[model samples]
Target chain A: MSFKKVVVFPAKLENLAAIDALIKSTAELAGLDARSIYAIRVATEEACSNIIRHAYQGIEDGTIECGCYSNMDSFTLVFRDSGHVFDLTGVPSPDLDSCLEDRKAGGLGVYFIKQLMDEVSFEHIPGTGNVLTLVKYLTPDSEKSST
Target chain B: MEYIVEKLKHCDLLSISGRIDSQSAPELSEALDKIMESGQHKIVLDMSEIEFISSAGLRILINAQKKCKQQLVAGELVLAAVPERVHEALDMAGFLPLFTIEDELTHAVGNI
Candidate 1:
């Protein structure tokens, strides 16, 4: 029902798996389902990978923090990174109607994150770094569904 | 991550096992490049053993698809026996429609 644990790790991509496992364990403890768990993992991976690639610009020395919270109905993950200040406002909404051949290669990461989670918001602290808050409701349907 | 290649009469099957994320994407991309260089454009990726995939992994797949299309291959890169978790990832990323997915390896191999 509240913030249980917060983990900080190097911005290196090697740490992504550890972060994924942490989120899975926390989501399981909060009684989320496989689909919900997988969604959270995808969303988290996109955000973290963005930090690893763009936020830190592939610098190995940067660090990222993942803070997880949950209640009976939902789970929230706050990803904070001290790599680069990312302005989420700059990202345009993806045009789903665009042809595959015409579509740009990048930009799908944030689109997928938006689709998987129930709520997503971005903040850039001028002095600190970028923070992305992602929330997914543990709906009754998700609880009842399997696989 | 482990990549095992099996040569077929008309195509080359690349079986990718383990997590293909930011850490392992480069390896997978390089493997795909090698396969393409060999002139075997028809590919059926046996993804049954892969436990997870990230956006980086998807980028590799997209690149491979583009390469195959550019080569004018008779068939595009296909995926066989994808696990539910991986399928969910593809679906969430809106990639399910982009791929020619099969539920069984036999079906994928036979179809192509």
Candidate 2:
């Protein structure tokens, strides 16, 4: 079986809770275990935060559309924003090996999205704006409920 | 997220419960800033009741840890009773080595 859910929210930090709730409920419906649900929540939150902070530059008037899709084998999240053209693929991975002195705070959001999701892609359409898709495969152990 | 600051004998204990995301991270940052400003760098962040944490929260943690350790006084931010899910998030971000993690809140405060 396949399931699809969509939600739209203003591109503001305050809407993150709503976004997180949507992701969590959708992941539970997709039969994801607690760990996998947490992974999806973190990845989706990171993606949305990137859109709000960088793409929109803290413009609360802007909007973000989130779509959740799930099948027997995988769950996916798609984010749409009509803000600046920010590409997650171009982000350099944070140097995790660096010591405390050299470590930086930024870039971890994109890094988390890339690390937690099994597949991630970002594209900018000429008129449609930025689209980020994150996919997490459902393993046998991670699928606790039936969808 | 909600945070309660307790001034311990050896360090400051910040008991945080609820989600720590981009929206709530700044508040947490401010709370930590206030603690650090008061010259209390040895902090025990009690994460037993925390529901979730994103990169935003992790950023605050790393920044706070750096500030605590880099000061001439050489203080520290210790994490205590971190839920398993948050622990995994920290591990994935390669942040496990950034601070000292304790399984018990009492241990965290006791050693700090």
Candidate 3:
């Protein structure tokens, strides 16, 4: 199947549902199984949520663009934002061994994106914007099971 | 996200549905705040109808549970009927062990 779709919208938390819905349909139509589709949708949602929270700082009026592309073997989702560039590399995954009383809870957004996707790349363009691409490899077991 | 709040046997039961992200996290927090302010500590979040969750949602749960623990009396937050998809997110976030989760609402309420 040949699938290349691009969606550009305001970078806001309210638009998260729309973004997630799009990712769900796109991944499902690409012949992915339920687990694969959920993973991709979650990663995409986390990326967009990061953009809306950190990049726009919940400003209510920034811009976010996403492209859903797929080939025979894998599916790729790219997110671009233009408010403030966020460096995901510097972000540390929350320590899981900490005590419940001492545990912190808000820093797991980016970590979810990294853990769920097979390949994740973040780039900061000199004069353009930030682009985060999350890839999901298609499996033969899921190819026969499409939801 | 939509929440259905009901005062059950031993705790305040909140049945949540729809997507819980940055936008809806505040709503959940607000609901919990109201319950907490009313001197109710024990709570159960039923995610049977919940389809999605993010860090924002998880933060609310953590905060709520933490505040409950700080109480001088009985205070607890449990989760019930969590879907597999929601479980995946919680597992990836390293939050599966943070709270008492049950396969059935009765068990969660009893456990709490």
RMSD of every candidate to native, in Å, equals 2.5, 2.7, 2.7
lDDT of 3 by residue, A60-90 (tens): 6788898999888888998888878897756
TM-score of chain B of each: 0.94, 0.98, 0.94
Local error of candidate 2 at residue A97 (angstroms): 0.6
Clashes of each: 0, 0, 0
TM-score of 1: 0.90
* Native interface contacts kept by each candidate, as a fraction: 0.47, 0.97, 0.56
lDDT, residue B8, candidate 3: 80
How well docked is model 1, in DockQ terms? 0.60
**Which segments of candidate 3 are over 4 A away from where they belong?**
A58-60, A140-147
TM-score list, all predictions: 0.90, 0.94, 0.93
Which structure among the candidates has the greatest DockQ? 2
Candidate 2, A1-147: lDDT as tens digits: 598998889898889999999999999998878877888899888898889888998465899999999998899999999999999879998988888889888888888887777889988998889999988888765333221
Residue-level error in angstroms, candidate 3, position A126 = 1.3
Tell me the whole-model lDDT of each prediction, alpha carbons only. Answer: 0.82, 0.89, 0.83
Report how far residue B93 has shifted in candidate 1, in Å: 3.5
